[model samples]
Target chain A: MKITILGCYAATPRSFTNPTSQVLEIKNHLFLIDCGEGTQVQLRRNKIKFSKIKHIFISHLHGDHFYGLVGLVSTFRLLNRENELHIYGPKGIKEIITLQLKLANSWTNFPLIFHELTSKQPELLFEDSKLSVSTLPLKHRVYTNGFLFKEKAGDRKLLIDKAEEYNIDFSLFKSLKKGKDVVSEDGKLIPNRLVTADPPPPKSYAFCSDTVFDLELVPMIKNTTVLYHESTFLEDQRELAFPTKHSTAKEAATIAKEAGVEKLILGHYSTRYENIELFRTEASDIFQNIILADDGEEITVE
Target chain B: MKITILGCYAATPRSFTNPTSQVLEIKNHLFLIDCGEGTQVQLRRNKIKFSKIKHIFISHLHGDHFYGLVGLVSTFRLLNRENELHIYGPKGIKEIITLQLKLANSWTNFPLIFHELTSKQPELLFEDSKLSVSTLPLKHRVYTNGFLFKEKAGDRKLLIDKAEEYNIDFSLFKSLKKGKDVVSEDGKLIPNRLVTADPPPPKSYAFCSDTVFDLELVPMIKNTTVLYHESTFLEDQRELAFPTKHSTAKEAATIAKEAGVEKLILGHYSTRYENIELFRTEASDIFQNIILADDGEEITVE
Candidate 1:
């Protein structure tokens, strides 16, 4: 799985920093998250294929989180996209986008589907044979939700030499890979474990942003391969976090540590901070594995 | 008068080329015209103070023309702006903007006033002691209007030396500047022309964009100091222009020539062309004093 950071700053977009927007590519799905203003230009700067994005997940209704969504939707129509697009966001998202389209009198030719999300409980958003996605209810000034992307276990690896020694028929390979006992050509039953090895462990990524320090999120994101949490401030600004419904770097690291995730990615930095490296310095003290998300940076899930 | 090009390309915004948005600084007002998706960032890049922009003029409801407006308005609220803002655009603009703000629950601290336009005839939108703004009706795919910013005639130059020669009292200087004859200190009547000269011809700027080659616009923008016209295509692509309701370089120049504008600024070029200089080449044939509009380029009206 590969994740690209289109923008990672907090608040209004500036000349050098952008607001929150990222692309998570997992199991052939490119999911756009929190499309802030200037996201389309950032996508172009990063050379991400616009058509590949079939699903977009927005965290909240905040301007910094989802202002660019309508523009992207319009751009898709301009590009003559024919494939259906799905948007998962707060309840009012569809109304906001459709209103702009109605005013412009430029409705999309392709199917533009909206999955309005109002549930505060953790509810499944999407699921397929290879992957599943669910909401992670977050505490913010407004109704918000983070998304958890989990890859389903793949087929077991076939031990070809062991299968051959067991006299398993070639036609039985499919059964063996499915972790089922197979009958050989001679009519003898062979144990699936003797012919196949365990599959690689599945990976999951949890994205949480624009939220206050909440321990409830730790259980929902527990033991995930990667966790991207918003650290809009440092510990020095802890007082400012609660009132604004944002998290500090140390608070995000604490959540990551409690969840025991393999890697923690910190983003959604407040533009007031001159150096983002300060986030790493503050977060690393609590969480040993911390990665700073920068615009245009790509991270591969290990 | 000064005009700053925040974005000048047509269609969707890209990494290198932006859509339509510009800043017109006339008198003490900084007017934002057609805020495309990335306009706030473009404003920052150009170092234009956001607080100075009290008025915004949107030509149409097209995404490329006004998508950034909501974000800009929200940013103003975030900046704790207390000044009132006036927006002049098509009828649906107020509904479109207010709906987004309502969804986000981020009502502006400043008063956001909307002047919805539904007229095909030239209509006055704003008037002040120093300047007046009117809508220049244009032909486009949707209900559209170009903006005409005309500086009101300034006080006639006092001609201090001539006033002294006439022995005019200092208390009557204001009357002399107003082009009124005043009794001199020696009780002699002084003619206004003898003591004052006409102030530099009040400058005007007409911004016409996303319109087809319509001669109906000529009378409204006639004899403006500078005219910024959309040249979405070159003459070679003139066939595509009429169908798209966009103007070609030569077509824009034709309008400029007929209007007798002092200078013609060509913008809103289609991204299909690699070199925008070709627009100047194509337009200069029809009208001289052609200037190609580019992102971040500033032009001082002569």
Candidate 2:
């Protein structure tokens, strides 16, 4: 799985820095997460195909999180997109988008499906043959949800030579790969392990942002292959973190340590601090495997 | 009067090109005209102060024209702007903006005043001591209005020496500047014209975009100092221009010639054209004093 950070700044987009937005490439899905203003331009700069973005997940309704959504949608229509675009966000997202389209008198030719999230509890957002995505409820200034992208272990690989040598029929390979013992032609039960090897372990990724440090979320995101958490402030501004509903680097580290994620990626830095080294130093104290997320940085998870 | 082009491309903002947005500096007012997406970054890159933009005028509901508005508003709030902001646009603009703010729970700390325009006829939108602004209704795909920024003639340049020689009271100077005849201390009537000269002929500017060639608007913007008209297509695409409700370079020049503007500035070029020189060539064919507007180009309306 690979994650590309399109923007990692907080509050506003600047000349060089952009607001929050990213692209997660996992299991044949290129999911766009939290499109802030100027996201289309960022996508163009990063050379990502606009048509590849089939699903967009917005964590919250803040302007910094979803302002670019309508523009991206309009751009899709302009590009003559034929595929249905699925958008998952808060309850009022559909209203906010459809209203703009109504005023412009330009409706998308493609099917625009909206799955507005209102539940505060974890809910299944999207599921496919290869992967599943669920919401990780977060504490923020408004209604917010972080996404969990988990790859489902594929069907066990079939050892054709091993099965053939055991005089197994090709039709029994399907059941053997599904971890079921194959019935022989003479009514002898053959062990599935003898014919098929185990599949690669399932890998999962978790994204959390615009939220204060909440210990309750640790259980849901525990043992994730990779975890991206917003560390808007450093340890110096730890006192302001909770009030503003943003995590400090130390707070983010504590959560990462508690969750036992393989890699803790800290991002969504406030523009006030020029040097982010301090954040790295602070979070490194707790979580040794930490990656500082910046715009245009791509991280791969095994 | 000075005008700065923040963005001038048509359709959508790309990696280097931006959509419609400009700054009209008439007298002391720095009025923002047509805020497209990524306008805030454009403002920063152009070195324009955010505080100077107290007023923003949106032409229509097109995503390319007003998508950046909400983000700009949120940025203003984040910057702790204290001055009230006035936004003048179509009737539904208020609802569109307020809804987003309500969802984010981030109503601006500064008062946001919305002047929704529904009239098809020209109407005065803003007025101060030195400048008066009005709307120029145009034909487009949506309910749109082009803005006319006109400088009100300043108090006739007071000829201090001429007034003193006429033995006119300083208190009566105000009346004389108002182009009224004033009686001197010796009961001599001083002609206002004899004492004062015209105030630079009252420079004016008109901005029109995403519009078709409309002769009805010529009378309202007649003899204006400078005119910036959208030329989304060249002569080759003239046939397509009318259908799209956009003007060609030649069509824009026709309007400028009919309106008798001092200088014609052509902009809002479709991204399909690689070279903008063709726009200048086509426009200059009809009008001699033609200025091709490009991003970051500055023009002084004398």
Candidate 3:
């Protein structure tokens, strides 16, 4: 899985920085998160294929989080996109988009579906053959939810040397790969454990942003391969963090350490700070595996 | 009066050029016309003061014409604009903008007023002591209107030599400049015209775009100081102009000639042509005073 950060700054789009938006590439799916103003331009600058974005997730109703939704949708229609686009966001999202279309007297020829989330608890929002997604309830000024994407474990690998030595029937390979005991042609019972290797480990990615420090999510995102958390302020602005419902770099590291995530990615830095090295320095105090999510940066997880 | 062209391309926002959008400065009022995508960036690149723009006018519902409206509004809000903003456009514009705010749940802190125009006839949309704006009905695929901005004839210019001879009271000079006859202390009636010359002929600017060669507007925009009209095609593609309700360079020049405008500015050229000089070449055939509008070009109308 690979995740590309299109934008990471908060508040507004500037020449050097952009607002919140990212692309998480899992298998063949490109999931877009939090499209702020200038996202389409950023997408173009990043050389990302616009058509590949089939799913978009909005954290809240803040302008910085989803101001680009309407323009992107309109551009898609102009480009003659026929594939269905799925949008998951707060309840008011559909009304917002429909109203724009109504006023412009333009509607998308493609099927545009909205998955409005009103629940305050964690729940599975989407699941397929290879991956599953669940919402992570977050505390913010408005109704918000982060997303956790987990990859499903694959079938056990075959122990080629052991299986061949045991004269395992070729036709029974499927059952043996499932770690099931199979009987050979001579009616001899063959143990699946000795013929099969361990299955590949599943990977998970969790996204949390525009939220206050909330440790309750430790259990929900435990052992995630990568955790991208918002760090809008530094420890010096800790007082401002709680009231604004944003996290400091140290707070994000604390959450990542508590969740035992393999890697902690920090983003959504406020525009006040000109230098971002402070974030890495502060976050490293608690979590050693921490990375600053710069715009256009890509991280690959195996 | 000052007119600045932010963008004038026919289609989309590209790296080198932008779509339709311009800034008109008249009597301390900054009016924005047809906000296409990247308008904010263009404004920033041109170093135009955002706070001075209190009103925005959208010509039509085409995406290329006003796709940047929502982004500008959102950016203003982020910039903490305290002044009220007034938007004038065709019906459905308000709904689209308000719906976006509703969906994002991020309403503007400053007051926003929308004037929805549904009339096909000329109507005064805005007026102040120094200027007035009226819609010029145009023929297009969509309900579109060109804007006619007229700077109200200024106070009569003070004829210093004549005023000195008349011993005009300095305080009464105000009334005389307002074109009012004033009686002197000796009971001598002084004609306002005798003491004052005509205020430097009030400058006017008319913006006509995304419309066909409709000379029916000649009388409505006649004798205007400057006329910025769209010339989306050349004489070679005149066949494609009528069906699309667009005008060619030659056609725009013809209208300017018939209207008796001082200067004609041609813009909104299609990207098919490698060089824009051809537009001026084609237009100059019919109109002597003609210039091609380039992005970031500014003209002072006297």
Candidate 4:
């Protein structure tokens, strides 16, 4: 999976910085996450194809997270898009978008689907043959949710050298890959473990933003391949984090450490800080593998 | 009054161009008009004080006209604005803005007042001691209105030379300046014209956007000091103007000529045309004084 950071600033969008927005490409799907005010312009500047965005996931209804949604939908209509579009966001999102369309008298010609999430519990929001998505309940000032994308387990790989030495029946290879004991022509059982090796590790990615320090999420996001977490403040101002329902870099790294994630990517820096280096230096003390997410940076998870 | 153009492109926001948004500064008031996406960034780039904008006026519900409103309001709240804000827009605008704020649960401490105008006839939406604003009906695909900002007539200019020559009484000077005849203490009637001269021409600015060839507005905006009318297309694409409800350069000039405005400014150009010199030449054929409004350009109406 490849994730691209279009913007990472918190609160307001500045001339040199932008608000929250990102693009995650898993398998053949391009999922847009959060869509701040200038996301479309950032997309254009990054040379990303606009039509490739078929699904959008909004963490909450905050203007910083979803202000670009209405304009993007309208631009799709203006560009004569005919493909069906799916939007997954908090409740009341559809109403706001529809009201604008009604007043403008410019509804979309294509199918526009919306999945309003009002639940406070962790629930499965979307699933397909290749990947599955579930919500991670987050603690924030408003109704908010983080997302976890995990690849489905695939067929097991065969240890060709061992299988050949054991003279395993070639026709029974499929059954062995499915973790089934195959019967040889002589009516003897061949254990699946002797023929097939364990499947490759499934890749998983977690996205968390606009949330307070909540350790309960560690279990749900255990052993994630890559974690993108919000680091709105530093340890110096940790006192203000809980009251605002935001997280500090140290707290974000603590969560990543508890979850045992392979890599931690921190973003969503507050505009008050001139440099983001403090976030990396601070977060690195808790989690060894840490990287600062800059606008236009792309991270690939194997 | 000083007017700053933020975005003027007719279509979508691109890396090189932007959509519709402008700032009209009259005295201490910073009146924002038509806030398209990326307007906040443009405001930052131009070094305009966002805190001074206490009022926002939208011409229509088109995405290009008001998509940036939610983000701007959110930024204001994030900055902890203490002043009340007023928005004058078409009917249903309040519903959209309020719904988003409700969903986000991020209400502003300042009052957000909305003046929804649904009248087809001209109406006064805002007024103060120095200025009065009224809507000018326009033709478009959606419900639309143009804004006309006129400075209230100032105290009549005192003809100091004439007053001294005629030995006018200082106490009667106020009544004479108000265009009233005064009776002298000796029972002599003196015409007010002898003591006072007409006030400096009250400056007026008329803004018309996304409108078709509608000559009915000429009488309403007749003799305005500055008129900004949409010239979305050139003379070559005039055939497509009627269906789109947009005016060509020549048509905008014709209206400017019939209205006899002191100066005409053309903007909101379609992105299809690279060169805008054609609009100037075409408009100059009918109107001698025409200025092309580009992004960040300032127009001072005196």
The candidate maximizing lDDT is 1
Window of ten residues with lowest summed lDDT in model 2 chain B: B149-158
lDDT of each: 0.94, 0.92, 0.89, 0.89
Clash pairs (backbone) in predicted model 2? none
Q: Which whole-number lDDT from 0 to 100 does residue A219 have in model 3?
A: 93
DockQ of every predicted complex: 0.87, 0.86, 0.43, 0.73
10 residues in a row with least lDDT, candidate 4 chain A = A181-190
Model 1 clash tally? 0
TM-score of chain B of each: 0.98, 0.96, 0.97, 0.93
After superposition, candidate 4 runs with Cα above 4 Å error: A154-200, B159-197
What is the lDDT, from 0 to 100, of the residue B19 in candidate 4? 88
Which candidate model has the greater DockQ, 3 or 4?
4
Model 2 interface root-mean-square deviation:
0.5
User: Predicted chain A of model 1: TM-score relative to the true chain A?
Assistant: 0.98
Q: Compared with the true structure, what per-residue lDDT tens digits does model 2 show for residues A55-168? A: 999999998889999999999999999999999999999999999999999999999999999999999989989999999999999999999999998999888988887788
Candidate 1 ranges with C-alpha deviation above 4 Å: A185-188
Residue B30, model 2: Cα distance from true site in angstroms: 0.8
| Model 1: per-residue Cα lDDT over A154-269, one tens digit each | 99999999998888888889888889998887889888888899999999999999899999999999999999999999989889999999999999999999999999999999
Instruction: State the weakest 10-residue window (summed lDDT) of model 2 chain A.
Output: A182-191
lDDT of 4 by residue, A121-166 (tens): 8889789888988888888888899999998888888877867666
- Rank order by DockQ, top first? 1, 2, 4, 3
